[model samples]
Target: MIAQIGDRLVLEGTHLGDARRIGIVVAVAHADGTPPYEVRWLDTGRTSLIFPGAEARIENRHPDETSEPAR
Candidate 1:
């Protein structure tokens, strides 16, 4: 997945009734926008490196604007 610094990452739960986790891409470790991204969680003000799974998806930084979703 390719992302910009302000993009949002949503990790869908693996099982039923599991809550979704959302985070913003704080840093792009690579110039090519590859993972292990430095993301700051929206639910909690915590940051970590994330290598996304199959359940992961991305929300564009400005949802009201005409930007594309990164995946």
Candidate 2:
């Protein structure tokens, strides 16, 4: 994974439940986009969360810094 900040996270849960959430990438721990992500989660009712590696989506951000999608 080589994503940047302010990007969306698309992850797959390996547990037993079926759920999904869309959040913004507030912080990036590693440059590889592997772990340690601070995201304002959307599943737990607009709360901030830190995902390890399996809970994330995409990193959709424009380099121009024009406008990002508030998803």
Candidate 3:
């Protein structure tokens, strides 16, 4: 679930009309290094940043992942 430079962030697969998208974590923001990643979701050929917290998992990005709003 950890997001990395090649991990895929899948959102609402079946319930959301089977809508699926993929992207790479271009950047990560974390202080203590824990859950919640500032993911840059590549949706529908476009790029969108997100901080999917407890609602998400970490299986790719480094351990120093955070949810700080990108500036």
lDDT of each: 0.83, 0.63, 0.50
Number of the top candidate by TM-score? 1
1-42 in candidate 3: lDDT tens per residue?
344554545554545466654455555555443334444565
Candidate 2, TM-score vs. the true structure? 0.54
lDDT of the structure predicted as candidate 2: 0.63
> Lowest summed lDDT over 10 consecutive residues: which window, candidate 2?
43-52
In candidate 3, position 56 carries an lDDT of: 47
Cα shift from native, residue 68, model 1 (Å):
17
RMSD of 3: 8.1
The Cα error of candidate 3 at residue 52, in Å, is 1.6
Model 1 spans > 4 angstroms off: 63-71
Per-prediction backbone clash count: 0, 10, 7
TM-score of each: 0.81, 0.54, 0.43
Q: What digit string (tens of lDDT, one per residue) describes model 1 on residues 1-71?
A: 88878898899999999999988898988999878799988788899999998899877677564543342
